[model samples]
Target chain A: MSPLLTFFLWSLLKCVVVTVVLLIGVAYTVLLERKLVGRIQNRWGPNRVGPFGLLQPLVDGAKLFLKEELIPGNVYKPLFLIAPIIALGCALISISVVPFGGPFTIWGSPNLFQISDVNFGLLVILGITSIGIYGIALAGWSSNNKFSLLGALRSSAQMISYELALGLSLVGVGMRAGSLNLRVIIESQTSNKGLLSWNIFGGMQFFAFFLYLMAAYAETNRSPFDLPEAESELVAGYHTEYSSMKFAMFFMAEYANMITVGCVATMLFLGGWTSPFGNLVPMPHNTFLLGLVQAFGPIMWFVIKVFSFLFLYVWVRGTLPRFRYDQLMGFGWRVLLPLTILNIVGSSLWFAYHS
Target chain B: MLLIIFILFAGLCLAGAINLLLQTHPINSALSLIVVMVSLAVLYLTLGAEFLAAAQVIVYAGAIMVLFTFVVMLLNAGKEERTLGSFASWSVGFPAVAVILAVIASVLIKSQGLGTVHLSDKITSTQELSAMLFKELVLPFEVTSVLVLIAILGAVALARRGDGERKGGQ
Candidate 1:
């Protein structure tokens, strides 16, 4: 095959594989949240579907597929139909630049374990996320329901406010790594000192990480910051008018966003795909297992770090009470935003001194 | 291939601009404006300004347009009513626009030694762009930022004055 054709084919294959895996990961993250929240609340969650509810996400997908879709009479038809699609599409696209593992040769071409490794990967993610707010805002507006409109407005406002802090927090990391490319940032963290060199530890970005954590939870509309969708106030929030697959799309989008946030946090702060032990853990030299370990080991480490972040997400959701609207706004603007700015200045000063 | 992509985006950009003008509903018009902004970003990308393309999307289509939509949505602005031709718009607007276009077209046609863009895969990296902005053009950059700050403060002051008038009347 021609090299260009090989490149095109491999890229197409990688896109398909990564998207499928990410969707499945989204499904299982929902399951993980349910199971963990269940355990926290002293109950077993979805245990009957398969062994330990392994088949639950599949069953849930089928159930949502089989459910009847409803279209309200008063909706703005064009935007109503387009809203969920925009939501899901933006969620899926942000993962294209995330590197899951190191590069490997295939079809005489070396391919990184990503759909595309853009130079401005981090900024692309941020830009996509900013655009994602439109999905919620339009869904609410098109529905013509007052409750849905309120929910959408609140959600968009919250996301926009938190995005400033979130972006600023990562500025410190970008400065430390001296690149916005995700892979280069990870490589910068790789040293013999292992975990110490990671941004949250030795890089003195611990405070920025906390700010990012809070801002990210708000960005994704996760619990404790989920004032927009408070069931007692707004029926089901921005997705109130949606049903069946449309509703399912919004649900999937939310979980996918959670997973993406986890992936980004893993890449930026926790040292993406790199083993915490650094070179202390030796790779096996046996020929057959060597390739296996080399390819899968980084992936394993990446998965573990992301899983822990997800666990933290669920843990906080179960523990903390939801913030009031005013409190949420106040916290993001007054507290987190300033702290992130301070973090940026401090990181820049530290880097200057060291250099 | 690059020419084809550029043509496609440029066409989309023109289409979106026309749509923005034609759409009656505020929300639809706002969305069409977003499309215009995004296609312009793609055009910038084709010209190898990758960072500029991203910033255009993030700052214009994403942030500024969202605020525009928020205002329209909050005010519950309905579809615009059709109106008879306005005298000033028909007489002044068309001629002014035509004059500007004529000037631009004549410049393009008459100018010799004007450079043509050679489409290549090379990108202007963010580091180089930042270095140029911060080192060579630092004064202008800082001045532009301060100007924007002044505009924001002026807006705030005007809004505060409105609140003060309302309170005094009460």
Candidate 2:
């Protein structure tokens, strides 16, 4: 094959592999949330299917598939059908730019574990995910249900408001690292030779991380910021009119977005795919077993960090009560946005003074 | 390959603009405008303006359009009342706009369309663009930001219900 064709084929393969893995990851994440939340509430969750609920998601998929897809007479059919797909598509596309592990050579060509490495990877993510709000908004309007419309309106407003804080908070990291490339940011964190270099610990970006955490919860529409889908208030909010696979699409998109937040947090703060102990695990070129160890080492650390973030997400969901709409918007705009702006300024000042 | 993609997006932009003009409801028209904006962003990407493309999506398609949708939904803008087009809009409007565009395109094409200074792929990206903006044109950049801030303030003022309206019964 020509080099251009070979590159295209390789990228296509990566895209497929990443998509499959991410979908599975999204499924298992749902399982994990249910089990964890059930355990928190002193219940067994879904333990019967295929040994400890391993097949539960598959069962859920079948159930959704078999359920009647009711399209109400008043709905704008095309927009209704396309909304969930857009939501899911927007959720999945950002994963292409997230660097999972550092670059390693295949034959002679260099490639990272990520699907693609755009120069403005972080901004691309911000732009793509921001557009995901349209899915919820369109779903709400097309449904012609009053409850769904109100929910969608509130949700879109909340998302766009919180997005400012979310994007601004990350600017601190970009400034500290002096690059917007995800891989470059990760590599920059590894330069301190120990724990001090990570954005959270030594880089003095704790406030930005703190702001990011709070804003991320709202951006993902998780608990405490989930007014858009308050079951008691709006009857399932934007997805109230949806059923079967349509509703399933929204559910999967939410979980996938949560996973994206976890991954981004890990990459930005906890040091992406880097062993904290400083290359203690050697890359064995010859032995199969040791090579596996070497290959999986950074990946394992990356996974561990992301899991910890996800655990925090679930824990926060269980522990905190949902915010009232007025309070949520006020906190997002009046509080988080200003604090994030300050975080950027303070971080830049710190960098300037230190240098 | 890129040419094919460009043609596809260009076709989408034209279709979306026609949809915007044809749609009866304001919300649907807004959505068609979004489609046009997104296709335009893709076109910008093909022209090696990656930062501009991202900003176009983020600022226009994402933020400003969301605001439009919110206002439309809040106000409950139903289907616009249909009316016969006045003779001026149909007879004079389309032809005038087309003539102007044709004149501009002809002028540009006749006068050496562009002076291409080939830049290495990576070097012509967002980093260079930002360097130019922050270093050489920082004053104008700051002034443009202030202009945006004024627009935001005006929007807020317009959205807030006045005290007189609040006091009056609905």
lDDT computed for candidate 1:
0.91
lDDT score at residue A34, model 2, on the 0-100 scale: 93
In model 1, state the lDDT of residue A142: 95
| Candidate 2, residue B22: how far the Cα is off, in Å | 1.9
Model 2 agreement with the true structure over B38-89: per-residue lDDT tens digits: 9999887776788888899998999999999988988888899888889989
Candidate 1 lDDT over A170-286, as tens digits, reads: 998999888989999999898988899898997889998888999999999999998778899998899999999999999999998998999999999999988889889777889
Q: Alpha carbon lDDT of residue A189, candidate 1?
A: 90
List TM-score per model, in order: 0.96, 0.92
Kindly report which residue pairs in candidate 2 clash with one another.
none
Q: Which candidate is the best by TM-score?
A: 1
In angstroms, give how far residue A51 of model 2 lies from its true place: 2.5
Q: Lowest summed lDDT over 10 consecutive residues: which window, candidate 2 chain A?
A: A104-113
Of the candidates shown, which would achieve the greatest lDDT relative to the real structure? 1
